[model samples]
Target: MNIWVTSWVAADDGVRLWTATTGAPGASWPVVLVHGGPGLWDYLGPVAQLLDGNRVVHRFDQRGCGRSDPSDDQRVARAVADLECLRRHFGHERWAVIGHSFGATLALAYAWTHPERVASLVPLGSTGLGDWRTPARAEHARRASAQQRARLAELSGRERRSAEEEREFRTLAWFTDHADRERAWAWAAQDAAAPHAINWTANRRLAREVDSWPEETVRARCRRITAPATVVHGAGDPRPAATAAALAAALPHGRFVPIPDAGHHPWREQPSVLRALLLRAIRRA
Candidate 1:
């Protein structure tokens, strides 16, 4: 079932969130999914299979992301507050959270402040929690993607891509399943058709505004969290395993699960493994 999650933020600005509920309204177990990009959609189509027992699984797009209205009001702490409001409004005393990429970033922020609210966290395709040199890596990726766009006709229209779009497309394209050369070409073609301008803007802003977060901010909160924590990462992800390792080390009850062949978007590339890992996390959650 799809539930409409609405809330107000810093200003009197109201935001409407799209939420997908797996089965019942109040299940014994609940997983609140936080999507990546702060400007990206939940992309919950593939991961829907994990809600087998018809438990309550929720996915929501942050303000200015997905179907939500657009806004440049950027702040990490504010996003955390928004999440807390949503959790309380949804009536979940404590929830297991699964954050993907930027969502994982929010997970760190939320978990840090409200450990009692989140029972556990399953961060997938985490962007930067530990030691991610995101600026340098993203800058390099931007240049590489620009080069790719120039050489390949499939990337014709992407030559004028924003720096963030270049980085997102180039990196995310590498994780897609093309099946063959033809499919790869087609995929590239599709990517060039519509560049992600919004995410690019948000990413650039976020990179500039927030570079790194200290564990102390979130660590003290983690210690209080009795819920088991597991991190699911794509083995093929370009972000690097060291980042995840560092993040896991910071947390007292953190376990890392690396899925083979999956890139940045583990759930998209390795659905079976993603499902299994999520199910396992659910059991543990």
Candidate 2:
């Protein structure tokens, strides 16, 4: 199959955007894969696997991540709006929405706001799009934060941190590429060496800008989205299963599938299964 890869910075939310496209040009039915971080890098590997050489896809580093410049917490809404610019930039009237983790929240929020432009929705390892401040999600946040500090100290030759500072460091550690400790730790070092403000600002951005889902009250309002929707979760995900189930059930045409032995990062844990399921979703769309 023919394929193309290109990077360009487009204007988004008053910031210059760094975006990349892979696969053949003019893929009639495009799937836009959103990476899970309110501040995470948009990953391309799993999406590449899921595409399986048969279809083309779009993957990019989201704002404040990778090659893109960082902005304030106010950039969240504007980041969501960037989806429209993405679709229109490629001239797709409607596109398939695939979001993982934090991206899943953005995907649901986007579908909720612009149902007319989404032909399909797939949210994996999702945080329920409801008021996302429940105890369970908070725990997931805490767990991810803990891993960050341990990895950070391991990377830099720094002395161990006090328990309290360890807790504080983890809060700012967003979703990191952890396929390998060497690679993951390199990412940790980048954060460690940066002037305290850049990293701390991201944490401040998370606290100041993120919003919770009105899960209980908000689902009733949007019934027009009849898209082929699939919500997949890791059976052993630290995040709550009930919330994932509730989210899938709430969608007018949602299908819920849970992967056994998988954790929050199911794509890495069960790539074969995830790839198969995602391919099926795309074809169905």
Reference-based TM-score of each model: 0.75, 0.73
| lDDT by candidate, in order shown | 0.64, 0.65
Per-residue alpha-carbon lDDT of candidate 1 for residues 13-67, written as tens digits (9 for 90 to 100): 5655555556555444677788776556666645654553456776666766655
Model 1 compared with the native: what TM-score?
A: 0.75
Off by over 4 Å in 2: 1-3, 12-14, 25-28, 73-75, 129-213, 221-224
Q: What is the lDDT of candidate 2?
A: 0.65
Q: Which runs of model 1 end up more than 4 angstroms from their true locations?
A: 1-13, 25-28, 128-130, 134-201, 212-226
What is the TM-score (0 to 1) of candidate 2?
Answer: 0.73
Please give the clash total of every predicted structure, in order: 0, 6
